[model samples]
Target chain A: MNPQPSLNALQSILETLLPQMEQGKFSKVECHFVRALLEQFKNHSRVFAELELSTRHLKEALGETENAANTLLTLAEDLQRDERTEDIGLQISEACAFQDIVGQRLKLVQKTLYSYVDFLALMGTTTQTSPATIMSGPGFTGEVISQDDADRLMG
Target chain B: MAVSKDMPILIVDDFKTMLRITRQMLAQLGFMNVTEATDGVDAIEKMGQKDFALIISDWNMEPMSGYDLLKHVRGASKTPTVPFVMVTAERKPENVIAAKKAGVSNYIIKPFNAGTLKSKLMAVLGPF
Candidate 1:
């Protein structure tokens, strides 16, 4: 048989295999597969940073949209008194459209922020367990539960 | 000499936002010297290398928890007298008992306002 591949060649093979491991199709893979996935995760700080920045911007945009909707509602109410004017119906329609757009954008922003928040919350609270399960016995107590678990418990 | 403005304060918590908020709140409260650790192990390593007047730690952390850090501190001769207070969401009786057993100076429950934090710190540190 041919000599075993060098450490670098083995690492390259594992690196090539990581995507399959991440897809959960290669469940029987070794610890190195998990390590490669974790290493990939560690290098994705920019993704999290962008998500944070996008969440901030989305929040600000939602706030501005809410303010605009409020202002439009006020304008529509004020214009309602002049029922005969052609512009009044147009203003009301525009206001309704603005409110709808604002509502949709707010929902989108909420979903985006919720996804990012949930991801960070997971990272914040997850506890790594060793393969031996030596530290997994019942004596352990009072650790903070993950955000998802906390939400489920509280809800 | 009294604890100067430049003396670092170790703020230990697993949550990054909580750490940032605590650091900001401490800065607002006139404690300018603040350092942060994401967990008890990081806090202990920092404490081992330097002297901090106070340790504000969250009771819940993976691997080396805050209670473990408190025990470690108590066991170490250099930092036995360091004022340690648990700032955690854990309000359970057993946790409190364990913290007290480990010689925690005070316990502050989470969602605590700045005023409550100041009051607890005053209670532990004798009005400052």
Candidate 2:
């Protein structure tokens, strides 16, 4: 029987090369994914930007209503201390919080877009030679980690 | 330590929105004096210029990450012991371990609200 390319360094080589191959495969897939994401990103960015603008306009419009309501409540004893009257202020503040949450989510996708490009750029630079195993974790997904888990890891 | 409201907190993050939200949260908690740094390198440069009561930094930055900044800050005798809070969207145990080992005073995850920011600050800096 032939020397069987020797199981010698084969496992280590496989271990090393398999990961690279996997990453390369991912990089290939991500190239297309990035293009799609970029196109989506353009539309997404425009939509979110418009959404943010529209929300701000709505909030400003509500502010006028709120001012009117406040003035009415103060002058007209009928509207004063009413639950529905008070609810307007509360509702506007809550709605303002909604726009911010949308902004946060929009930022997450933007970061994801950056990561896709960065990853592709990195793989592009290292394709000829062995790619450095970037241990940097996946790109930001806007997920929150628990403090307990954080502490446990610290320990 | 019952820090004061005008404790001169430093907020570091690349995103304008994060910085704005953080500043708002700090303001809500009565931390009126706030400073902003766009990234870890910018943060290090600013910290080198003046001492801040606390440093709140986002973790994934280009070239100089929050982890890299933490290491540099810890290495520098000037602000080595300053309270550094690592803000990140990462959920990796090893990343947390890396920050903690790098001498982070506390950690705040992403999409955080004023309440979470308040609790983290209180935990690290004591009550206002």
Candidate with top DockQ is 2
TM-score of every model versus the real structure: 0.46, 0.56
Q: How would you class the docking of model 1?
A: incorrect
True contacts kept of each: 0.00, 0.25
List where candidate 1 sits over 4 angstroms from the true fold: A1-155, B1-6
- Candidate 2's displacement at residue A135, Å, is 7.3
Q: What's the DockQ of model 2?
A: 0.19
Write the residue-wise lDDT of candidate 2 on B8-107 in tens digits.
8898887776677677667667778889998888997888777898999988765688889999989988888889999876667777877888899988
Residue range A29-105, candidate 2, lDDT tens digits: 65555444444434444445544544444444455446546654554453455646644543333223333334434
Candidate 2 regions exceeding 4 Å error are A1-145, A151-155
**Local accuracy of candidate 1 as per-residue lDDT tens digits, A4-33:** 876445556667767876777666647554
| DockQ of all candidate complexes | 0.02, 0.19
